[model samples]
Target: MTQNIGDALENSTSQASLAHSRKISEKIEQAIKEDATQFRVLTGDRPTGNLHIGHYFGSLQNRLRLQEAGVDTWVLVADYQVITDRDGVGPIKDRVYSLVTDYLALGIDPKRSTIFAHSQVPALNQLMLPFLSLVTDAELRRNPTVKSELEATDGRPMSGLMLTYPVHQAADILFCKANLVPVGKDQLPHLEQARVITDRFDARYGRPKGSDKRVFPRPQGLLSNAEMVLGLDGTKMSKSKGNTIELRMSADETAKLIKKAVTDSDRHISFDPVNRPEVANLLTLISLCTGQPQVEIADEIGDGGGGTLKKMLTEALNEHLAPFRARRAELEANPGYIVEVLHEGIARANAQADATLAEVRSAMNMVY
Candidate 1:
């Protein structure tokens, strides 16, 4: 089987990471075949804004699959992380609840998946202390996520939280011993750091060599199957850029947005992301909605022009999202249920985190 396994590990372009990605990709397949119940997955979203199609295609869809496969899945609403790079955390409480609503509406069954708020889980955050000690300041600066976030902030001095954002994420994963983290190519580095932290702690503090007491599982990045989901303007889909379609937008709102999506003057629709990115993005969105091959969709819309392509997308996408909208409306009507779900998740997360922390302390001989 020829594998461009290189792409799955696009976490790093180096030969080593490519080789490692191939091995993990195969392990992921085997893990699904084995007793999946033995594996736990930790995935999350920072409640910065409403989730967009990029999120759906990028990670959430895979999350739903993992949930259905009977794997233990936990979705963290990283409420505190929202303040990492930003100055003022905007309507965070609302966004956090809205995130839970989106998850429920999108079929993330709380009964199966533990959906928790980071701020509500104290024990989990407690793991950050020992984790912080395990990582060096030089290592923190070397993190690509830290560098990228720093670059995003125009020369402003970064906060201590921002400097150690990656370790916080490592804490998120290790606190629960989550072995699989669904991530995009851009997030591979963050997952790598979590693995590094788990290994470091295990080495320095874990039980003896012959009878090693592994307190944390080295998490692996389960690469998303979707390509880089672009915005209507053919740029990275971003809420800040206003180029995204939020998951909660009504059908009419979605149609209005798609109507304004960028496209070329060519009447013939085709999938050529290289030279005709805008047209290709529209086609890709349509394919994602209808689950048809992009080339086939483009051929089906040949010579129909951008208007016809957008029309098809608006229709397909609205139909696809209609059920989610209905579900969300019902969930919105009962805000209590949303809070109940979050509270339950926090309880479960606290239990797991406390257990891990207790064991970690014992391993490090810090129980005293």
Candidate 2:
């Protein structure tokens, strides 16, 4: 009887686990759908260099999906933010336009999405002056992303702009009255700051018809399902590190980069990230591109050795990226069309920013 009871309990536990997994999946799909309604969404790249596949799967894909779902999307070319982490802006001056070209290459249709240079929207930054005082230095210090960035500088004193990047991000979101900000878990703190500042402003100024005031909707961070993709070297895939595969690269270039990627000395192709980070990382990259689950991919590649794994991964990545590469080439062939799209996106984004700024100014009693 005791053995029978144990079997029953095990079966019950297994069923419960299956139910929980299904529930979580449903919740995620529901959240994505829920967040897609009557919403203004803001997302962008820092434009440090050409974006890699990591950028596409991590954030850009989600942005594209949101736009397709009819969410009002704004893609910011974060030119100023790049200067926060780097020493010079010479390459950026040249590369920013390329970023827009790549955006056009991707499926970010300017007809539906707003794409613009961050610096051009001066009115957005104007809100930062009043919003800055609402948050604390300790709060900024506590932001994980901020700490990681500052630590990378070996404790070098940061610029005022660098220190207040979170606040600037807040202004970017609230300036468009964006209710949905798609971010990874790492960026949650900055979104929290946006919420805090919005609440503080509304509380201080928002009254009634004949009374006080309120303006911005405290934007929520619609967390991304995507995980942070590490580079070939098992570090963050960054252009400066020379570890990235640019989205605009040819199939030959993609294969070369993958072939050279670091993997374990062992011959076996197993997916044990904790024990073998290099092989596991490669496996994850392939899985991401192919939409296959990590475990299933590991099983299929089953002890095939590094050479075999690399070849398979190379094929998978190229196959997945070929369409985008072709599109990018076609788009690059016509610089005029790219320019028109960017200008049109800027006009739309500026209109939204201007309207939101007006509401903010009115709420703050800055204007009679």
Best by lDDT: 1
Q: Return the TM-score for candidate 1, rounded to 2 decimals.
A: 0.94
lDDT of each: 0.85, 0.77
- The clash count for each model shown is 0, 6
lDDT tens string, model 1, 94-160?
Answer: 9999999999999999899999987888888988898888777766776777777778878798899
What lDDT is reached at residue 327 by model 1? 97
Q: What is the C-alpha RMSD of each candidate to the true structure, in Å?
A: 4.4, 9.2
User: Against the true structure, whose TM-score is highest?
Assistant: 1
